[model samples]
Target: TQGPHPVWEHGLNGRGQVVHVGDTGLDYDHCFFRDDSQPVVFYPQKNEKHRKVLSYQEMVEDDGTRDHTDPYSAHGTHVAGSVAGNSIGGNGVYNGMALEAKIFFTDLADHSQSLYLPPDFDYYFRPALEMGAGVSSNSWGSNDVTTYYVDTDRETDVFSYFNQEMLIVVASGNSGRRMGILSPGSSKNALATGSSGNNMMTRNDLSSFSGYGPSWDGRIKPEIVAPGQGIVSAQSDGRVNSNNCGTTSKSGTSMAAPLVAGACALIRQYFMDGWYPTGVPTPSHGFKPSAALVKGMAIHSGHPMQGRLGNRGGMLKGELPEDAQGWGLMRVDHVLRFADSPFNLHVENNVTLKHRERWHKCFHVDSGTLKVTLNWVDAVAAFGVRRTVVNDLHLTVDSGSAQWRGNRHTNDFETNNIIETVQVEGASGTYRVEVYAKHVPVVFPAGQPLALVLTGKGLREAACPQTCGHCVHGQCVHGQCVCNAAYHHVDCSLCDDDKLCHGHGKCHDEHLYKCTCDPHFVMDDCSQCEAGWYGPNCDSDCKCGDGHCDTVTGIC
Candidate 1:
């Protein structure tokens, strides 16, 4: 129900992965920081004078100086706990997604207050990449009211676009339902996460305070949603609970971002362990998934949440809305299942397309829907540039005689992801998916790296029955012929019972019925005789007995 705990039960606890949390700071000595067998390593801030020590607990208290015991420190600790907190007192209820993952912290807040600056992105993201962190959890953002447009630090965009190895998951900000997302999260390449409340049921509802978006450029923000409301995680020593346990309840997009980051860590471990889809090729040692692939899997496998909570206006008809709820709530189980499926294909690689070059994948549709998603991190542009997508790729699906294109708005340069879904609707046949580079910048000598994930029931390798052709207007379901409305015969070839060949023929092939003639009769309808015929219906013989006579001419 909640993230297939079987993932950990199967020994995929992010054994060798690292997750970086950029916030105030973390409580390194908390029980959550220590696994059952050993202690989790902590990577302290590099340049900060206060955090240069071996442990955050060693920081000296000064005139209102922020330490590991401050309220702001609890925020980072809670976020870190959500990413990789181990169970305390042998209880598994509070265990994090990647319990065994090592954590690195960067205090983005200034010494005096919790105010964050844009330069923090460079300070933290660069080092995390250098340390080989697979995932980075960022819970802080600019003010929602004060910042309106897609005003993110240019350096952040450059880091995210260049470092395809590590995924940067940021909070979508608690800016209510209408205010949109905040900076850093507003960066087109980052995986911005929104808040959702666990309902203890099959689905989680969107949190009302979670920000919604159609970014200033119209690209979808908050690419995925996760459980964030009233989440329990580790608390600083100064804010310990009455039971003396260092844990507290907090809610916001801040809590949601780390959950996704931890999930990424688990997925990274899955790849690092040499486990890939059935037909996929496992890379050599030191090969990890690209950030675009991680982000694509999380978004593509998500469940859509448009009409569930009566927030069904706008573009919420069946398909996923571009601006709101993104590709829906993140389902870790689905992502794992997709990765393990033998039939589906997940391609995570870089391909360069020289002018008009196209990549095509041909597959057969058995009897259901086909879904394909193409995502890539675009290059960073100058501040205030109207177009964000430097390289453009288009997705198109051709099934049988019909063709469908992905959702492309008028402003195509603004969006970086393309999803194309085709419902066979009973008509099953072969399909071809084409991904072509529509445009490429002159400066990019090597093509961009694109993450492609193709899934659905149609991808399963099942052959249709040979008799499927008889069903003219309908599809073949489970080796049976499901005929269209106009036809009613067994093989769906004859129009009606009245059209039968006077009980002389039987409908057996894709075409009309064939007649079983007697020894003397010939022709498809059995109305003509073999040799010499005369009288009514050619039943009477020609009187030239013992003499050979022509079938058509009675000359003897």
Candidate 2:
């Protein structure tokens, strides 16, 4: 009856939350979501309206009123249905990942639409993030030639916000060109989803129209792949909609993005009690996974489906190509298992420790940021790091005792997704790094190498205990936990944007990328999409085309 339900059913749904689908709005009356009518927050600024929901059209001239309808764009409608559609009349053709998830439509189609590219896109993203949407799916992108970082004009380019607060998925562009992933989509922060197929047996091959990676900076692109080619989902108008609900032989990274978004919603639902090691506070609803945890779990656990043809790839060793299936196929089931596991991290008596020795967990430390040299036994190099990974070294410390107390001083090291290195310089003292991770699959546990290495500079010893703030458990003295140059304090935890500190401070772990909004700046994050533009993170414009948004201003 529930049609297999949302992949991650145990977590938050659109019920108590709102997920903004930035695209051409859906045909609201589509039976998929209409049968079990749910309230949708319609932001007309995007120029979208539901004929079945709205009585009159916006001030704009050409687009028809409530009664007159246009041919259903199977693309947008399918994406929406996968997210909030009610599967009642679904006929199994279209059942949303988060059927109960709320919908906020930012229609980029209309010129006079209140939420046009200018303001609506810019303002909408922050509002949604601040309000705490579970996730947002944008199955659109552009071929514009702009640096993927903070754009001056496009205010809606909030991919960084999505990465910071909630999980945001974007289509890796369907141009089939070499490394042609559109602007924001190509950005690293966002989880760019590619397309795969229905059958789960084959290896996930690179789609013809799907964009490929190695961003301009040479970072891996299109984090993961999903079913996109010839995908069959919901439809708006019935004529084009097959009686078997709505099936179409479509192709594009657009179709692929939603499947992952839906799957993520399901994982959030399944693993209701947040994973402990992630350090996410017990959600108001007890426990909910954070975007980082979700991303990490999904990427690490999902089945390896790469090195195949026509999308749906394989998962075994050496199955997919490095470029085609970056990591592997989207494994909905593995993520669920991670959610149900017992994992935790703690620092006691100047030692940091992590448990649940199954997943790849490490305590990262930076240079200068010295510390009571933390070392590990089983945590060996699981993944290799590059030079740019200067900030990516972890330590697995083991306190000789079991201290799980909720003390913010020792236990709380919140900065980025990884731990900040504490400057530890003192007489050579033995500190055991303890790690509780699955050395290898239960079946294959030997030679997998559980050896761990706590990376950092070997510093000169400190004279006394009280040298730097009584030698905080997770930090080093005289070798205190120092923030980066632009950063202030350990983990660079606070953003000066809120006017608390000056000169653009960095917020510790949670809000790492955001620059504190300086004085007189409109946005609190100090980041803004220059005037005449707007989008999720101020990355895009109202660039529209026949079926695409305008290139210049993001207008249709």
Candidate 3:
């Protein structure tokens, strides 16, 4: 289920999408890169002289010095293969999530250098955007020791906010139980990913080396986790003797990031391909989901794992711990299933919210839970600012009698998304969801863009009773009030008459009928115990300090 097989079976293979991978250069001649069935379009490198450039600045940077054919550095090739590699060369054993998706490579690491600085956001992100790439995969990050040297930038945030289309996926470094995440991965707009084990059923545990997180400002850093352990992918030149002819296995958050990036491609293609679930209504024109909506769907569909392993971090209060597993392990199947759920309603585009503005929706629910999530890529703050939430939106759910608020914790103030869940156990009523702008940034001229998803159980009609009498201490099952083992009556409203003693005991019958005997009485009917005995059926004598004693209390 973690791979692309399930998604491809639904006829979505990311056919028209382009994903950008930023790492060491790829081996262009690898058979996995060239498939007649679904050929991958490679981004023209600086060395390609005849390739057209978008601008003069891009043309000047095309110095042809970057060698994309380096076989020694197989990291970038492995990452790309895990993303969009085809089955033509690997005998269908090592196909990526998006087999038909195009690949765009950006050389961020040189094989000759041992230590290289992280690439600027403009170096790869801007290029991917210019080429109309909807998703970008980044498998590199700065080490924990170099945190002081890396400057947090607002470029990714600015691009995501203005563009509102492309998604950036970054690897949360393989630092294990470390407190903070890797550098560019900590960006507010990017989807920071941690590593899960390869086994999909047991993916709740994070990889031993996958980084843990709470960003510097205390927001959940790695928003999701994916399979990364011992992932088999294509190798450069087919000469590396690690595994089968042209494939090798690698483990790290680097391997996990591309899986998510490929998933993003499939999600983008699902909407772009005009594929809507059956019985669900669509507007006159096919709707396209925003990047924020996609991010929200991924995070909201995550399955929580923090409490299962007794690894509950102190900061975590609810079922999910933001610092440990973020939303939880990534489940693309759950995301797709949620999209097809009849009860769910997703916003197709971003909606602007002015100061003090509100949006509301009413839905009916019965005997289950109601969940609502509001997500947005907030405006980027200055590099060193402690607070990152630029536009604070509030989510509230009213069930007529009570109301629940998202972000209910008093101390948390930095996260950009809000999720609210209400329990409607055995209740039948209409619930109202309200989203309001609590704090809007003055810099946002038009207003903040937001995406909302409403999903959960729907209303269920009650089963009718046949006799039409009041049910007591029991519920109607198959048109009748089912009684407990100790009671026998039509509506389960009367005590068991057979268990009542002859003026010696009292019958109690709330949950079930039972008898409380008098001081000298014992037995099911309280008709066996005599003057000298007290126990049930007169099996034991009353023990007291004196010879003469009361039967039940054993008082002298």
Candidate 4:
């Protein structure tokens, strides 16, 4: 939310987006919860602009006790504010990341602000899914189990795998230790977050309280970090014992989680508005980026940190996405790529892969940082399992004679994790980044849906014919040649049959890419006239009169 007013002015502050929250409970009556300055209204009324929470419900546990039995959280209110609360309550100062976005709230807490997933965790998910929320922000987790893929973790991953389009954001707990991220945060598909100081861009100022992790199963935890220390957000009137609208300054990984979720709201909107591929939302190239794609974009956009805090957090691994900082801190602009001139960004978003199938992008890079990120929503692993990754996809980048494998040295690609990232100082040559399915136990026939994001300074997806053969005037998208209007076929090697010589002449060969015009007209398309007039070019003046005419003889 840095310089948020300008972000709103640019129309990138999460307009036309909705993020759901599963927490203690949201203060629906808070002024910041309302859009603009209008009064708040309860559920079922459908307040389009005046209110921000599109749906709200309290969870009823399997034991027949409601979550409202516990004291309501001023903390949940603060977290929701950080996600989508308006700045009106803060007098325009304490704005959420996606200020214009709406939200759905599901109370999942019974005892306190800390989260507790019941036996029927699906109950908390129904309200948001029914309301069509694309993202869910979870600020609580079970820190008791360490970073294992426990039942909660499996359930979280299973729901996302089944839903496909929904992304759940979780917070790394406050405990500061290696491999100490909480459950659900340890969920394979969750966008787990760490805590960074507010003033910094990188994790150089990473908070000491922020949780650190490389999950028990070897997946990097807290995929990104954001401003979590001393963050200010809207406070609930009832929780603070005041009826007047107010704001509160809080800290923890909880605060950090919502900031990332808010950023995702903007990222989701960028896609829905069809502004991502080429930044043109006019006709709307919009598509819902699968959870894998959006998660890849956010994690890929993060920047690494450097300092004592960085050294301590990162432990000088000489590579990115280590335990403490993960991929670094969130950079919203990098995801949007507003003008398209700065970074050479390319994405194969939501493409399916089969067993032993290889998907690759061949490009050339001059001298810059090259990063390849792969994310997939893996199938659920059963409870009490030593391994959690269900469908393993291997990532390798071949640059010249050197090749870099993702999570190098982990070697357990099959059971490693669902995300694999390869980053290197790219040389000046053809670079091929390949994602090969290693052990796709499930998703047969249909293929496993996944996303790959690539970016660098001078990276160019230059070679098309190498991957897609004979693609004349065509660009490859999603493993297929997107031929221009003039070309067609599997490789886009064929030209238009009806448009050959404008139907005025015969075609010698489609691959020749030339239309042999009739005696009447001449041009590439046979659209123009030669020195002498032909049949149609006669214009009812020449003596051809729909009859054959030879220019050499001038006879019909």
* Candidate 1 error regions (>4 Å): 1-4, 35-73, 88-91, 110-113, 118-120, 144-153, 201-204, 239-244, 279-286, 307-318, 338-343, 408-428, 458-556
Candidate number achieving the greatest TM-score relative to the actual structure:
4
Instruction: Report the alpha-carbon TM-score of model 4 versus the true structure.
Output: 0.76
Candidate lDDT (C-alpha), each: 0.63, 0.44, 0.63, 0.72
Full ranking by TM-score: 4, 1, 3, 2
What is the clash count of model 2? 98
Say which prediction, candidate 2 or candidate 3, comes out ahead on TM-score: 3
Total clashing residue pairs per candidate?
0, 98, 0, 1
- Ten-residue region with minimum lDDT total, candidate 2: 399-408
Candidates 2 and 3 compared by lDDT, better number? 3
Q: Residue-wise lDDT of candidate 1 within 1-556, one digit each (tens)?
A: 1454756765678767778877766655566764334332334433222211122311223355544433534687788888988755433567677888777666655444364544445655776776668898889887744242344545666887777788889998887556788877877788889887765642356776778676766667778888888888877663423223367789999998998899989878776766665423354533578887777777766776654432333333335644657777887665564344423544545555643356765666555556666777777776556646567677655553455555533222223543332333453566656566655555777876677766655364344333333345566765344666544422343332223333223333444445655446666655556777743334457768888766555666
lDDT of 3 by residue, 1-556 (tens): 2345656777777787778887766665566664333322334432223111111111112345534443554787788888888755454577778878777667665554232433455665777777767888988876653232135436666677777788888898888655468877877788888887787454766777777667765567688888888898877762322323377889999999998898888877766666544322233434567788778767766666642322333322335535657777776655554344545333435888875466665666643555566778777676555556577777665554455656444322223543322333344567656666756755677888887665555533223323324345567675445766544343454454344654356667543334676666766667766656654335347665447655555455
TM-score of each: 0.71, 0.53, 0.70, 0.76
Candidate 1 clashes between residue pairs 3 or more apart in a chain or in different chains: none
Off by over 4 Å in 4: 1-9, 35-46, 59-73, 110-116, 201-203, 239-243, 309-318, 408-415, 442-445, 464-556
